[model samples]
Target: MRLPRFLLAGVLLAGSVLLLTELFAYRASGAVAFSIFTSVWLTLSIVNAGLGVFSAGYRPSEEAAALLPVFGLPAALAGVAWWAWPDGPTLPSPRLFWFLLAGLALWAAIALLAALLIPHATRETALRTAVAIFLPLWLALQVVNLLVGVLIENYSVAEELLILALNFVLTAAMPLAASRLAQRG
Candidate 1:
């Protein structure tokens, strides 16, 4: 079961966001910020990956697809770790990995559900039509997420920039790439 390229982008975006979250943690709310951003990063990954799957038109393998819901696992685990040991190093646990797997399953389900609800509508004209609908919503969500993250982290300029960069890279750039590939294909 080969993963799609855009899906890889989602994963990369998640990792980058996680790193950026860590970088800004001390400036924000100290150790607690790390845990909060960790969960946010995981949620973003799941959402982005689900979007990628739909845009790519590739179906996930049965076994792999079943594990989508667990994609949110990382965030859950991060929160748990923070709760369990407020002063300890945040170590990645097997439970989190399992949850991540569940997130993947949940993601797959969302993608599938979106497909059923929205229909393809990928024709050049339809895509152009939908762009009007999707772009603004996408940008809005990204910006809102950015703002919320910044606020949660206590208004760090660097964190805001990180969110902006992440939004551009994952939400904006990747979708444009997908649109181009879709046109070519």
Candidate 2:
């Protein structure tokens, strides 16, 4: 696919995921955490969509080049957001910069793993490989978070597990759905 078309797919995927996150957040928390969760989800969805498009059938050098935006865009945006709205509720403390940095590292790792694991095959096959590789890694991370009380909040263990499962399904589905649409187009 062309760069512009790939980017359009990324934007559409980001928008859809953002919309879903917003709806879920509103229903679950009665208010959207626009500055934090929504922003992070938007960044993840956009980067993941880009990864889905460019991960397969590319030379190593080209894949490295493609990874620039996948990793850089979110970090750049987060820095800009921190600069623009330093007093925003989501990032009231400077320490939240650490969270942004950690998120960047995690995204880079996930993208690398997906790119390495997905074979150069049909789009559907590549997407399936990605889902297979990513879901387990994602679940493992969630389990670590649960054990470490990273974002436990006030929820019971069962509720947190349910939420994690839902998130895993939705997150895994997004790139697959985007790839399907891109293939059809």
Candidate 3:
């Protein structure tokens, strides 16, 4: 599919997600909202990309190229905003770190399962398959890193500006990384 149309669809999906999540009071706090939003968005983006590969006969590279920017932009924005906000997002407890690590394996396994389900997609190189599968998944969690902008916590306006900047950077970077991964094989 053309990038513009694909992007429009992604935007629509994101908007719908935001609306529905809001209706459910998902944004009651930054942590809760980001978790809900990222989890849902990640699953949808990955499944959609996987479908393109399995059903539409698209290359892993093509799906990766389209998927990254389409999903990463808003995620990065929300992440940076969460960091810059004064109380700095009441993050999950440190004890949950192991759980997250386990979750990453689960994410990868699920992605691998998707590739396995589509026998044709499995013909692609391991790296290519991984890039397509994990790019969106990694991008989904991009908002989590917003916790690192320790200095920006006190500056709301600066945070907003950083959010915009980081969004652009991620929008550009994700596609570039995907393209790079696509090129590797």
TM-scores of the candidates are 0.33, 0.39, 0.36
lDDT per residue as tens, model 3, 110-180: 43444444445532443356556655654444343333233344535566456535543544354346446
Q: Give me candidate 1's TM-score against the actual structure.
A: 0.33
For residues 1-185, write the lDDT of model 2, one tens digit per residue. Answer: 43433333333333333333332332322123234433554565455445556664455566557556654454454445445434332323432233333333333344434443444555555555555555676567556545443353555788667656655555555655655674686
Number of the top-ranking candidate, with lDDT as the measure: 3
lDDT of each: 0.45, 0.45, 0.49
Sliding window of 10 residues with minimal summed lDDT for model 3 = 17-26
Q: What is the TM-score (0 to 1) of candidate 3?
A: 0.36
Clashes of 1: 20
lDDT for residue 121 in candidate 3, whole number 0-100: 54
What are the per-residue Cα lDDT tens digits for candidate 1 across 17-72? 33333333433332454455455555655554565466655455532463353344
Clashing pairs in 2: none
> All candidates: CA RMSD in angstroms?
11.1, 10.8, 13.5
Candidate 3 collision pairs: none
List residue ranges in candidate 1 displaced over 4 A.
Answer: 1-122
